[model samples]
Target: MDSLQPILNSIQKFQQQHSQILREASRVAMISNYIPDEAFRMAKATENLTRQLKIINSDSIQKAFDTISSIKLDLHLPSFPKFDYLEFDEQRLERITRHNVSVGWTLTGDMPINLYLRDEYLDMEHDEIDKIFIAFYEEDEYVQLKTLIKNVKNGLSEKWSEILDQSLDLYLEGRYKITIPALISVIEGELSSIIGSSKYGKRLVDEFHNKLDDKMKFLTIAAYSAYFFFDEHLFKSHDFTHARLPLLNRNWILHGRDDPSAWKKEDALRLLNTLSTLQFIKEIEIAEN
Candidate 1:
């Protein structure tokens, strides 16, 4: 028995560390946005924007952004898909995306988190697309996230305003444990509201099936990720274990089984952005109906 003392102590310590979780059998988990050279990623994202800093007045990119931003769904339902349309200059998109992919980054579209708002620029003529791209990708505490918050602040549903504002503050303060759980919860809540269904977890992914177009850039991006949250064995589908590595597993987080150590800024930020995209879809739905 004495020989097993050290092993027992290790197990005890682990359980003690997560006592709060055991108590709850419960609880929850975003990014305000990554780490391990988060600074480098921010700098690189900004620098990479320079690599393709070419925008033409009335280019398709600009047109799509303008249309999506202001299109009134009721009046423009037939034309909605037209305005929503965007094409990528394959080479340019590849350049922009490849680097981001290398860093484990992806635009949160369908889930529409990508800068390719049909998803940039250098010294040529800058326009709204450039601004949005930066807003979507920049990891800087100093970026347009504040502007995003401010612009939408007055417009958010009261329930959302509370959760989002508090989560954002926690994320910015590097309190991933608090922010991550709340974002995960609110994200699920918002999705339930969006789909007008009570479906939860992987069930939510099924709700999106009929709603997606696959051809529309933003819709596809946003919805693809919503599915991702519960699909592809990220969570729920897998059996739970304390030894499992954390990688944005919704089940583990919600069950209070995930280690906060693995919940990085990326998790919080991505979910926040996902919530933002979901809000956009919900607003569009309200307008159309």
Candidate 2:
């Protein structure tokens, strides 16, 4: 399993904070002599804050569980044991008062009433929870890749926005095959908008080549190299002449030439990154012109 230390450490920190807050609340209730209503209000406020932390902890656990479960189901592996969030019991404070009395030649003490509140608490197997998170992170490379796509999408123009969003949504929903083609559409649309209609493939490359001097020629070639390399690598099938090309085999996805059952998360991620890079170059070119 990949290191989930960051998330696990965060959970531990929250747990420690929760414990400290509960202890503070208990101490406040014990030492304070505020009116009954005021004390109750203060206690309730502490309880509310404690409840919010509990919710955050539970949400983190649930996200880890769901990510692991999805991977297990997809790979036909045995599922991890299901676990539930720990629920804390409600808290209440009781007020008490003490008095002393003297009789004849002797002094006596009455029962000293005690004021206290139950500490907020919940318990779980920290090791087991950590294991779940570890498993999720081990197989969760797609999430990191999706974040890359999202960052790139943030800079995209309004024309490509909807398709970029749709592609991301499809990827997250496990529709891996569909997302590849959808992302390819984003690349196609953006390039067409930049280069104008009736010009793509070799023609677009030539246009850049024609417009550059010797010094700028390498930049133009480098830009075209990225454009053609990604397109052919991710979106095209190998021809006899192009057998050495890196093949993501997205042509199968786009043309329905074969079943998309072989599509993997990495394939979609690579395509998104490739398309994002191409769009970024195109944006620069548009600005320069």
Candidate 3:
């Protein structure tokens, strides 16, 4: 993926360079119309004039950008497939759920209560969640996976924050080359631990199927990730509420834009937050809790 950074940077540079060319050509076109026949024929001036505009109008530039940006880059954690949640027994899940429930209760209380139950639960559940947040590789395989996850999550989240915030500028201006892939890389890199988890891979893939699109495949991939981790079910709620859902009706209903690739970054992040939070709650809620 390091190779991709340079290519992306080049795309940005090319866009800026060509934009200047386009502006100059437009000015030349205006001047040529009024200038006498002499300047128009001076330096193969007809050819030069047409050539500049042709370069500016070439569809290949935009198509090239679209192709590179659309190329899917799966940012899976290296050891994800080995960590299987289903391997744990029902009793283990119950234990983890009890821990999560106790923590939820304790977090809500004002004064200190007998949090021994809560602490016990949180400690055990924390181990599992930590494994999901960080990589669950052999201890020797990753001496500082915990620290790595923390740093990466912060950096990656901030990176995607910028992309989502500027989605409109990139798309509307035909600058997909500079924006789409960047958003994908940031989101995938940030959420790799949970996104790549074997426990949730099927779910992630399922969501991707629903959101996939060609024009904005990079954004679509990112959006699916948002929904994968942060959808509505993760939070505590009596039932599904319209306001509770991430990006609820924003595309197909709100804007009538069914194209998933066109979704803004914040919308994608909101979806991810909703899905992930709901998933966390559902995974913790046992038959008893």
Q: Whose lDDT is greatest here?
A: 1
In Å, residue 284's CA in model 3 sits off its true spot by: 23
The TM-score obtained by model 3 is 0.19
- TM-score winner between candidates 2 and 3: 2
TM per model? Answer: 0.52, 0.40, 0.19
RMSD (Cα, Å) of model 2: 27.0
lDDT for every model?
0.46, 0.42, 0.32
Sliding window of 10 residues with minimal summed lDDT for model 2:
96-105
**Residue 265's C-alpha lDDT in candidate 1?**
67
Candidate 3, residues 162-217, lDDT tens digits: the string is 55445434533545334434443443343343334332323544443343342232
Residue range with the least summed lDDT across 10 consecutive positions in model 1? 23-32
Cα RMSD for candidates in order: 21.1, 27.0, 23.1
Candidate 1's C-alpha runs over 4 A off are: 1-114, 117-141, 151-156, 213-220, 233-236, 242-246
- Ranking 1 against 2 by TM-score, winner: 1
How does candidate 1 score on lDDT?
Answer: 0.46
State the lDDT at 88 in candidate 1: 42
List pairs with backbone clashes in candidate 2: none
